[model samples]
Target: MWIKKFTIRGILVGLVCVFFLSPVCMAELPITSSFGWRVHPITGAWKFHSGLDLGYDYGTPIPAMFDGVVVQAGDFGDGYGNQVMLYHPAMDCYTRYAHMSGVIVDVGASVAQGEIIGYVGATGNATGPHLHLEWIVKGEDGGYVYADPIGLWM
Candidate 1:
């Protein structure tokens, strides 16, 4: 009887561990394609700009990084143009896609990883067409802190 009770308690503990760890293990963003280019006519410099720049003439599709709720979506007016901000509870992180031509998701909407959320564009303070992608960690005072999106992938 003692051995059986010990085994049952171990099993329960294992199950609880799985439940809590699953979400952290499951956050990721898919890369469709990436390209490095010389700064456009707007910004004349061949600085080492990293990150995959998905190019489309118009009406290109952009996807979400992970399964999360849209905490904010609108024209932020900070050179981001029409942007979408997603909060991933599982990852305990947030993603910001900026300079978008259009936004497909709404605030409070649940989106799966790699799901279409917006299209690329030159808006806000952008000189050319591109998405200023950023990964953010939760900060104190209900604010978000920025992280290098390229570094996150690396």
Candidate 2:
């Protein structure tokens, strides 16, 4: 399928960008939880966490990990709270910023790497103020998958 092909190309492009581009400029927020299957903090049930929970004071600015255009910006009541999703055409991947007190970017707006896109907050199934960051990639089956982001911004 076309989606599969595009995803494959995206993976290659992402590798090249990772090697040739400047280091990712992420905020130095403390990671409270990492990506993977784990016990849910709220429900106490086993679940797969799709992102990193970066703990910080309320209203702390959250930065974009790569140059991208905002594709979605708003609350959908999906347990992500006020969120921003960016599509990095160069890498053919998407990054998500969630649980924000505020979103500064609008849909379709271009954001540079490290630009402040939102603020941290305890929204949507959160216990405290933090930013839930997710790196999303398209799988070979043309479905989306979560990528561990510990190495990308650490």
Off by over 4 Å in 2: 1-29
lDDT of 1 by residue, 1-154 (tens): 0000000112122212332333322133323323234454345766333233434445566677677899989896655688898898986877777778899999999998778898888777566666666566655545555543434333
Whole-model lDDT, candidate 1?
A: 0.59
Question: lDDT tens digits, residues 51-123, model 2?
Answer: 8787778997777777899999989989999999999998678988999999999998998877888888887
Model 2 Cα displacement at 86 (Å)?
A: 0.4
Which ten contiguous residues of candidate 1 have the minimum total lDDT? 1-10
- Overall lDDT per candidate, in order of appearance: 0.59, 0.76
